[model samples]
Target: MGKNDFLTPKAIANRIKAKGLQKLRWYCQMCQKQCRDENGFKCHCMSESHQRQMEVFGQNPNRIIDGYSEEFEQNFLELMKRSHRFSRVAATVVYNEFINDRHHVHMNSTQWATLTEFVKYLGRTGKCKVEETPKGWFITYIDRDSETLFKERQKNKRIKADLAEEEKQEREIRKQIERAEQLLPPEQNRESEVEDSAARELKLESGVKVGFALGNSAKLASKEKTEAAKLVFEEPESDRGMKRKADGGGSKSALEELMREEEKKKEKINRKDYWLCEGIVVKVMSKALAEKGYYKQKGVVRKVIEKYVGEIEMLDSKHVLRIDQQELETVIPQIGSLVRIVNGAYRGSNARLLAVDTDKFCAKVQIEKGVYDGRVLKAVEYEDICKIVQ
Candidate 1:
């Protein structure tokens, strides 16, 4: 019944006027009030309640502003997560939506003077990925909660572990190389020590042989020279040693050379960042496929398209499907089973699985027949080696 009563028509009209967002300049942050115009804001500033709030703020301006800044940031990010968590939305669009809440924190009370500044702060703090295009600033939310951080930490740990294992394997290979080099001299000197010294020491004593003869000396000396010449020319032991070294050095087969060239090509292909290969058994890991009865089912890769998508024939169902490499997991075979190196240094080569380190998700494989024959890859990832379709 009263003019200023809550249920009066005048009070309803005021509420309706305040229902929508008002200009920031006419808002009184100290009293948490939004005025309709500059005159109203001026009048509110002159009021007792606003003056009291201003005095409190004046006592610790920095702390008050910082508190408001934190609250604004929290509310803004909360809205972003709830609405645009996985989208690239314009900053202005998000800001407009945020200000729709009647009781939302105002930007004038925060550290940033403008929305652009706030968005830039979000980028600098790594809260969102911000990019400026012709339309204005666009932002994508970056989830950094406990679960995301835990997953990222696990990924980094796996990477570091793999790098450490690779280094260990390289050191072991280097030691093997040193041991091999040390064993070579022994092979070249397998003959008797006296014979090796006589043969290895090819130079003659003082580069000449002294001979003295009495009567009939010329014929005897000539005969002696002929026998010495025969002995020098027929050096069977030294000749055999040289021939063995030559054979060992040239023992690389043509097949081995071809594999070496293929490895070089693979090294170049690795840069293309493609990993799919044909004739390998892989497990489908797609949640979408689960509804179609294909999730976790094994398949044989018949052909690879665009170096990423594969045409796979399901082993059990005999149905063909095209799937991205991301939805496929490599199938690890039993020890002694032949596997193809689908990634890493010896990619495209067939290797025999020697051992598996389940803890590290890596395997020790010996290259079966190639330039790296008998060479052991000590820490190939499970995904980098796969079983052939059988």
Candidate 2:
């Protein structure tokens, strides 16, 4: 058919409308043209321009595909690295952000069929840290920039250097303290010698200077005389030496005889004092126990005996300890008891006691704050709370 003969206004209008909505399926990538219909696309396929473009593409189609694939991968990784550097987010989230740009490389045109496959490729290639969670697959982009790696290494080196400096200073201070302690003994001896000399000078000024000097000489002579008297009256030097030799021979005999007598005496005392058992180490309750004097001077209790009675000394309050009692009475917080917080963020606020921990001496309370109700606070120490109402 002739062109004008087939181009009726009504026919032309219908063709134009079809062209407006017709899918541009057969497109020439190199020639950059779209045909309106199948017949038109077939005609264009036979055209010289389309044929030339096909010849160029046919020469090395793999190279063109590879270039496009590389571009797609580069654009995707850039988006992921910029948007979700540290976060382990879903691949779809990053893809959606990437597609927001109209010029962004489409995934369907790329080698990866799905986002999950692309993420898996990135993980396999060590481009990202990928993991599958209950929610979905997530990924963190790996930064391969040389400058960033250098900065991280520098930061770690500085931290290690600071630690080394601190350790060196600590060692120096320890050495100074040890040197100071070593000097203390000589310093104390010098002070003692000065004090003795001062005392001798004070005695000389008390009108006994010459007399004290002579008396000291005489005391020294008397000490020597006493030593001589001991040698003459107690035993002759030769006899004393001989006696020491004989005593050495009888040393084992003397020790055995002494041990027998001591055992007999110990048996007699053990019977009389056997009923006197030691007391146990218990929490004291009296004012005397609170004093530093009592802590410094009192001997420790070693045992708790039957029918043993002693006062509990807790600072000022005192309670008598009855050893015969089966159970010791202790104060315990009751449920629903009102208590005042003595410390912490909720100090001065009142709460209802919910539970008591006897072993820890603590309580769980429902704390009320402002319009908020019933906050469960755990392990509030007994000392940190006061019973307001039972």
Candidate 3:
């Protein structure tokens, strides 16, 4: 037939049959050629180029098969690693994805006779986690990359470290519980008597007791005054609204006299005998006047009133709160010292120290900026204080 005639229907049918993988078994591995049929394959074997290729392959047939097997395995594993690195996939499912690449090495040319055999080989070599399910064989890529191994090792190490830290904390807690139990025996009687105000009392890590007798006495005195119908003075205003200015003055004097008498009674208690220092923190007890919002406020002791009562500067520094010693808790940080907060929402925040209860290790801090900036003070722990260099 003429070259133009080869494009006819009969000739086209012949050409179509010669292409594609219809006769996979008859394909040449060394020459990388396929034939149309048995006759065509016989003719291809007789060709000069085919003879030269076959002659070279014949020198070491096993070498050629080994090369093909290696190529096939490498390409298959690369596909599995890239496409299904994190999934457990069926063998057939992976095979389907692998064949999508037209240039992929065919299994027939390799040593593995079937996909099952290749999967078994992969499992045996520990390249993949393999399992036989009811449906079929499933495979998951075994991540053996150096980076992946390192990350896994790091994760395990962190988990182990966390477990160890937790165990240490538990051990510390057990020790604390034992110590508390031992101390409880000696203080049980005193603790029962003090139980009523225990909730109001702040305990410091350091064992220093703020005097309570003065606070209780002040409470009793205040209670007696309330029962006696003592006239409470109103805020000083213009005489225009006063029924009698003289009456107001007389009432004020009476109030002063009553206070002086109370002071005299407290003086017998000897205030200076308990503490040797000033600027210690104390809680303003319940008996303190609530109108100034100092009933439960924190203040630095400017002076001790009658051994138990304290004349203190409130957190604002603008007001003073005078209360019995029981209301005050000694805070952690010392006054006029610089300290950094270590716990709570303001952790890592730096502030100037205003007052401290050395017994309790609790401090009142004055923060000028940030979330803690306000007229009111923040109470924090001595442990939370980060020491400043200068």
Q: What is the TM-score of each predicted model, taking all chains together?
A: 0.47, 0.32, 0.41
Writing each residue's lDDT as its tens digit, candidate 2 over 109-152 gives: 45666777777667545577666667877877777788987986
Candidate 2 vs 3: which has more lDDT: 3
| Model 2 C-alpha lDDT versus the unseen true structure | 0.51
Question: lDDT, candidate 2, residue 123?
Answer: 58
Q: Give each model's whole-structure lDDT.
A: 0.73, 0.51, 0.58
RMSD of each: 21.8, 32.9, 29.2
lDDT agreement of model 1 with the native: 0.73
User: Which sections of candidate 1 miss by over 4 Å?
Assistant: 1-15, 183-390
Question: Relative to the unseen true structure, what is the C-alpha lDDT of residue 38 in candidate 1, on a scale of 0 to 100?
Answer: 88
Residue 312 CA displacement from its true place in model 3, Å:
79
Ranking by lDDT: 1, 3, 2
Which prediction has more favorable lDDT, 1 or 2? 1
Off by over 4 Å in 3: 1-6, 173-390
Q: How well does candidate 3 score on lDDT at residue 127?
A: 73
